[model samples]
Target: MTENSEANSPGWFDKPANINRLIVALVSACLVLLAVEAIFGKSFYDDHHPAHFPIEQMFGYQALIGFLAFVVVVFLGTILRTVIRRSEDYYDR
Candidate 1:
């Protein structure tokens, strides 16, 4: 295709996003999750001490753990790639 044809081609806005539907879906998911937690979070919010941590803390810890795990995985990948890297024609005669 020519440059003019490519330039006229559709981008993301060619199909507009449903802002209202997205907002409604997001709100509904949050409400459902909150209801589920309220029903099953009794034990976590029962003990009048460290055991009585808020659900928010659990979410925070989960996020922190995921980020740390991702960082470790990425670091290991970089190290391995560097250690095993070779020229593009290393195997060619």
Candidate 2:
């Protein structure tokens, strides 16, 4: 790719330092959110939930669940890819 084309494309996040900064920023934001939730307590909807699950009231519970779900999805997708993928030359015959 030419310099001009690369410049026009999304190259801002291509650097390792940029990616690290992004990760740090996201983690910091999550920590701040967790701190706020701990100080202010749950929302009205969460407070009035039918089930009294202890884990639900924990700080960062939603984030933990979301991260775990994402991990599971990625893991499953990797496994499924190996199972369903065919040889590149399978259709050449």
Candidate 3:
């Protein structure tokens, strides 16, 4: 029957509840990492160096920098694609 076939389908993640649970788990993990870093993280660089700015001492600074860099790269890639993308037809000669 149609009901039996539907019940026997193997798509565990096809439900909205499963997707929500996955999102919650991932967010919870990120929060835990952030909390751990905030409580126990230490700078790896020398204190007297110019590179060791005060703002850099804050927790999650590296993550912020990485995320910003990723956004910049994606923006630049979008611009490059517009400049270098080929036409749909060039072999019609």
Q: Write candidate 2's Cα lDDT for 1-93 as tens digits.
A: 222232344776688786686678777987898788787675623444643788866777888999999999999999999999998998896
Better of 1 and 3 by lDDT: 3
How close is every model to the real structure, measured as TM-score?
A: 0.38, 0.63, 0.60
The TM-score obtained by model 2 is 0.63
Count the clashes in each prediction.
0, 0, 0
- Model 1 has a clash total of 0
lDDT: the better of candidates 1 and 2: 2
Q: Which lDDT values do the candidates have, in the order given?
A: 0.61, 0.73, 0.72
lDDT of 3: 0.72
RMSD of each: 10.9, 6.4, 9.0
Off by over 4 Å in 1: 1-10, 13-61
lDDT of 1: 0.61
Residue-wise lDDT of candidate 3 within 1-93, one digit each (tens)? 222233445775588786686678767877897887776657544467544478877778877887899999999999999998887785664
| Model 2 weakest 10-residue run by lDDT | 1-10
